[model samples]
Each structure stands twice: as structure tokens, then as C-alpha cells.
Target: MKVKVKVVLKDGILDPQGKAVLHAINDLKFKGVGDVRIGKYIELTFDSLDQSLVENETKEICQKLLANPVIENFDYEIEELT
Candidate 1:
């Protein structure tokens, strides 16, 4: 099984890194760039092929360490690999 996790800052939260990325893009003459929100992407390999169990564990991992529930939110997808 494989799980993909994406962690991003919640709405109304200030993201200096995202802002910096936007500014840099504009400075480089890239036009029409809208609000940029930076996030973290993580991949995990699991021994079980059970989708439900893997998703549950992934959520737990995110809540405990991968993300800050107070200021950040996360979503994950689980896939079984043969």
C-alpha cells in the first residue's frame, strides 16, 4: 500500500514562504500568477493493502506529526500496490 499526504496552511493564515514565492515569480517576469500556497507532499509505503486501515493510520500520522491541526490542514489518498 502507498499513501500520499498533502499538508497545507489553513485559510486566513499568513504564509510568508508562499508570498515570497509569488513575489519571486513576478520578479522573474512571470505574469498572471495568483495567490500561491506552498505545501508539503509526503509518500509512505505500507505493508497492508487494506484501504480503510491505511487511510486511518495516515490520518493519525498527519494529526500527530505531519501537520499542525491548529494552523494547517491535510488530505491523503491511499492506494494498494501489488
Candidate 2:
């Protein structure tokens, strides 16, 4: 099984890194770029074929290890491969 986790800042949270990137984009002559938020993606592979179990475990991993859950939100998807 393969799990992909995405962690992103919650709405209304300040993202300095995203702001800097946005400024750089405008400086590079890119227009119409609005608010941008940065996030993280993590991929994990396992031998199990259970999608439900993998999703549950992946959520746990995000809550315990991957994401802070304070100012950030996380979601995950599980893929079973033969």
C-alpha cells in the first residue's frame, strides 16, 4: 500500500514563506498571482493491501508525526498496488 499525505496551513494563518514566494513571483513579472500558501507532501509505502487500515494509520501518522494540527491541516489518500 502507498499513502500520500498533504499538510497545509489553515485558512487565516499567516504564511511568511508563501508571501516571500509570491513577492518573488511578482518581481519576476508574473501577474495575477494572488494569495499563496505553502504545504508539504509525504509519501509512504507499505506491504499491506488494506486500504482502510492504511488510511487510518496514515491519518494517525499525520496527527502524531507529520502535521502539527494547530495551525495546519492534513489529509491523506491510500493506494493499493499489487
Candidate 3:
């Protein structure tokens, strides 16, 4: 199975990196760009074919290592690889 995970800062959390990018966007004269939030995208290949197992493992991986449970949120999708 192939898993794709996304880790992002929770709402109400301050993101300085995102703010810097937003500032740069404004400097470049791009109008109407209100917010820019940065996040992490991870791709993992699992040996298990069972979707449920993969899902559980992915969530555990995100919570234990990939994301800061207090300040960040994570979500993942599992796909069967041919």
C-alpha cells in the first residue's frame, strides 16, 4: 500500500514561515492573496495490502513522529499499488 500524509499547523496557531511567504507575495505585487499556510507532505510505501492496517499505521506514524500532536494536525490517504 502507498500512503500519502499531510501535516499542518492547527488553526489558531501562528505560522511565521507562512507569514514570511505571505509578506513576500505582497511584495511581489500579487493582490487578493490573503493567506498562505505551509505544510509537510509525506509519501510512505507500506508492505501491507490491508487498508485498515495501513491506515492505523499511518496515523500512528504521524502522531508519534511526523506531526506535533499539540500544535499540528495530520491526515492521510491509502492506495493500493499495482
TM-score of each: 0.91, 0.91, 0.92
Off by over 4 Å in 3: none
Compared with the true structure, what per-residue lDDT tens digits does model 1 show for residues 3-82? 98999999999999999999999999989998899999999999987778888889899999999999999998886686
Kindly provide the TM-score of model 1 when superposed on the true structure, using C-alpha atoms.
Answer: 0.91
Error of 1 at 43 (Å): 0.7
Give the total clashing residue pairs for model 3: 0
Order the candidates by lDDT, highest first: 3, 1, 2
Residue pairs in candidate 2 whose N, alpha carbon or C atoms collide under 3 angstroms: none
lDDT of each: 0.91, 0.88, 0.93
Writing each residue's lDDT as its tens digit, candidate 2 over 1-82 gives 8888899999999999999999999999988999789999999997877777777788888999899988999988777776
Which regions in candidate 1 have their CA more than 4 angstroms from the true location? none
Which residue pairs of candidate 1 clash?
Answer: none
State residue 32's C-alpha deviation in candidate 3, in Å. 1.7
> How do these models rank on TM-score, best leading?
3, 1, 2
Of 1 and 2, the candidate ahead on lDDT is 1
